[model samples]
Target: TLNSDTFTVTKVYSDASSDPQVGVSLACDEGGPPVTVTDSPQTTTGLTADFTVTGWTDATQVVCTATETSVPPGYNSSGTCAAALSPAGGCTITNTLNSGTFTVTKQYSDASTDPQVEVSLACVEGGSPVTVTDSPQTTTGLTANFTVTGWTDATQVTCTATETSVPPGYSSSGTCAAALSPTGACTIVNTLNTGTFTVTKVYSDASSDPQVEVSLDCDESGSPVTVTDSPQTTTGLTADFTVTGWTDATQVTCTATETS
Candidate 1:
């Protein structure tokens, strides 16, 4: 006479509520040959297979083991895969989810001269927001890193950056945004401001000199401008000067000299 026993193997997720249809295989060493069975779509309750034995009085020791063939994306198998068969039932295998990480690199348009600007970085992933300011208080090229381990493989994350305070002579422009990945990067830019000024020349004696040439010198790094007083009238003469890409903190001084 022969006896038959039913054995079962179950697959489960540790971090997820629903099954991800992981692939599993069960191998059992019978008396003569090894019987192998695979589950097409592994469920939480598992699949059951029947095994044949000699009889109830048979002394054959049967061993069954379960192995994972395929796992869900962004997840890893962290459970024990091997088990010994008994009259009770079979074994249960667990799959764990993996964590994801990303980085944000901070940049400035005037990093060469003004690198002490502070910026606020924020990141969100379907949950609470995480914020971090520039490290080292005052430094150039700062970075903020984030690590999230509770999300599934299909989750998406977004990060944004904004200037905490604008510098004296610069204007804040575009912001930074990115879809988070293992290795992602973004940039924020600021533009230097510009303005114009005028230089006026007046003559004490209109008839004394028919025409006079005057040289103007300023603190700004530029060639001196020579203005020719034409008609030598008492009315004031004016010259337009433009300063491009200057900051509010810059100090400007001007001086005039009579060349002729």
Candidate 2:
């Protein structure tokens, strides 16, 4: 058997030829093409076929060769194929043109995806979601108001100030009160939120001891008297006076007389 570029099978005749033979025919693995029979897989460079059934056993060896046809412009590539006795036989076909690419690719964010912890004042135990924003509590002067505004659920507001600078016995859990000292320097704190509130710096000279008072008012004008106590206008006129545990702006004009 001989090879050709167009994959057509070419037959070689023996010395003892045609006229002496009783029968003569050709067969291929697949049905023969019009003129040539394709007996084996196509030619791969540098490798040979296992065996070929070219008829009678009279010839010691029937060598089958493979060849490549004219490969079009970009289609041409050098390749090799080996013969195999079984399915797992070592018949490997490799490409000659080490050109085009066969690629496999994979993409991946570096954001913080952790849970958060929120602390709030909470009006009725827990109603809606309202968080106290980050702010400072103690400011320096008088009219400077520290506003802490991050409440999503509170309607009416109430606050508290835990005395930080005073001696150990001082403790407060109420709203803020604005009281101007005789020297005109004072501190006004609004504990309307959960965290440390921001302090507004209003220029004043209130150099007084750390005495806190609680003043409850519906709004700025109402003055509903946070700590219920009557301050008889006497010795030291302070927004903070002592009657039981109450102090600060105690004379709220009486809630029953008007709206106070």
Candidate 3:
């Protein structure tokens, strides 16, 4: 019959900056002390060279695995364990880290020189919101970039932008859709509050005489109406108002009536 044998388990890191701590569990024909590992730039703990177990029957096999509890930030505990082992056999497990990048873009529909615009970004990963500020008035448009390191691959990362400050005469565009991927793009568009309205003048009588020199006045207290011809155009007028006009003809002056 063969004498008792020994087995060992080792831990390693692809990235030295990854988790510094590792743990292990062993099931063997010959029991041993609790196994634990800690990683460092100089040396990684817990290997046959670093740590070893003794007293297993000569041909008896040993099964070992890396425990996942308390994994370090940005590191995966899913490191694979080496194949089943026997006398004098060794196994190695490796921890991994993740990384990626994303972009954010801001846009305005009108050519207005708004002050600096600020957007807020957040993630479900439990970090504080990141603020991205841009002076659209100076840049014409704005784009920002972000990089994520140590996040698990395939882990859903979401980023959203909200307008914190706006230019004069503008309102917030609200929040945008949460960015779907690490490489995804988030865009926000702001619209000008001011718009144009068309005014058309209709004559009840076509024979009213185009040269009657009709004087048009708007009810907006300080607003001025520009008189050109039959259909005079008013500019820089805001809000709703009533239009009043008069003809130079004395005969029709008294009989002139204002209609909507």
Candidate 4:
């Protein structure tokens, strides 16, 4: 009389809290029908299916393999799929979550030179936020890399950038809210501040003051102004100057010379 033996297949998940559970199909080399099962929610336990086959003389060897038919949104199968039937007569398959990487960049615009500004980048997954700093920035900009492991593939991640320290003559602008993409980047922008300068000339000897010429020169280019005061009187003379483009903290020198 040929006796029957039972073979079991189990599905195990590394992340028990994973939603939309994973499913797998199990098959054996022996003449038993294939069985399919879904993983249990508990990490310590697994879901199982049993197959009964006849013709076992105690020397029969059986091999089984498990294949993932469906995976959760953000997970991948990362364990051995094939195994020989153990003395206990069962096999297990494991599934692991997936991970991805991205970048955060800082950019400066409208500035005469690189401000070398410092900034902070914050990225958030479902859990806590991850923050990093980029200092001594350049005109070409700076970048920071981030890697998030053990996350589901469909999970949404967000990032934001802030200027920790702004240069004396610059202002920040533009939107920095970025969605995470593999090998992608989020950028922040800054512009230079602008203002006007006024120069006033007062003559100590009003009645006898000679016709004079006044000139103003700045260390930075495109910031020079010259004015002529003819037939000077008791009232002082004033000249308004505006820098053509952007200017940082600069040194200005003014001089007056008698023309008559």
* TM-scores for the candidates: 0.45, 0.16, 0.44, 0.50
Candidate whose TM-score is highest: 4
User: Count of backbone clashes for each model?
Assistant: 2, 10, 1, 2
Residue 79 alpha-carbon offset, candidate 4, angstroms: 7.0
Per-residue lDDT of candidate 4, residues 112-143 (tens digit): 44635354556676655543333222334365
On a 0 to 100 scale, what is the lDDT of residue 88 in model 4?
A: 57
RMSD of candidates 1 onward, in order = 9.7, 29.3, 11.8, 8.8
Per-residue error for 219 in candidate 4, Å, reads 12
lDDT for predicted candidate 4 compared with the true structure: 0.50
Question: How do these models rank on TM-score, best leading?
Answer: 4, 1, 3, 2
Which segments of model 2 are wrong by more than 4 Å? Answer: 1-129, 167-260
| CA lDDT of every candidate | 0.52, 0.25, 0.44, 0.50
Candidate 3 clashes between residue pairs 3 or more apart in a chain or in different chains: 47-51
2 against 4, candidate with superior TM-score: 4
lDDT of 1 by residue, 1-260 (tens): 45555456566676654753646666666554664443422443333323332233332366666667666654677534554455544777677665554454545554644545465556666655543323213335455454544444323656665666666546776467775664344665666555555555556674443343445455444533222332222323654444444444245555655554
Candidate 1 yields a Cα-based lDDT of 0.52
lDDT (tens digit, per residue) of candidate 3 on 163-200: 66655334456666554353466776766443222343
* lDDT tens per residue, model 2, 216-236: 222113533233333222222
Error of 1 at 192 (Å): 5.1
Instruction: Report the C-alpha displacement of residue 6, candidate 4, in angstroms.
Output: 10
- Give the winner by lDDT: 1
Runs with alpha carbons beyond 4 Å of true place in candidate 1: 6-8, 14-16, 20-23, 36-60, 78-80, 87-89, 110-142, 148-182, 189-260
- Among residues 3 or more apart in sequence or in different chains, the pairs in candidate 1 whose N, CA or C atoms overlap within 3 Å are 169-247, 169-248
Q: How far is candidate 1 from the true structure (C-alpha RMSD, Å)?
A: 9.7
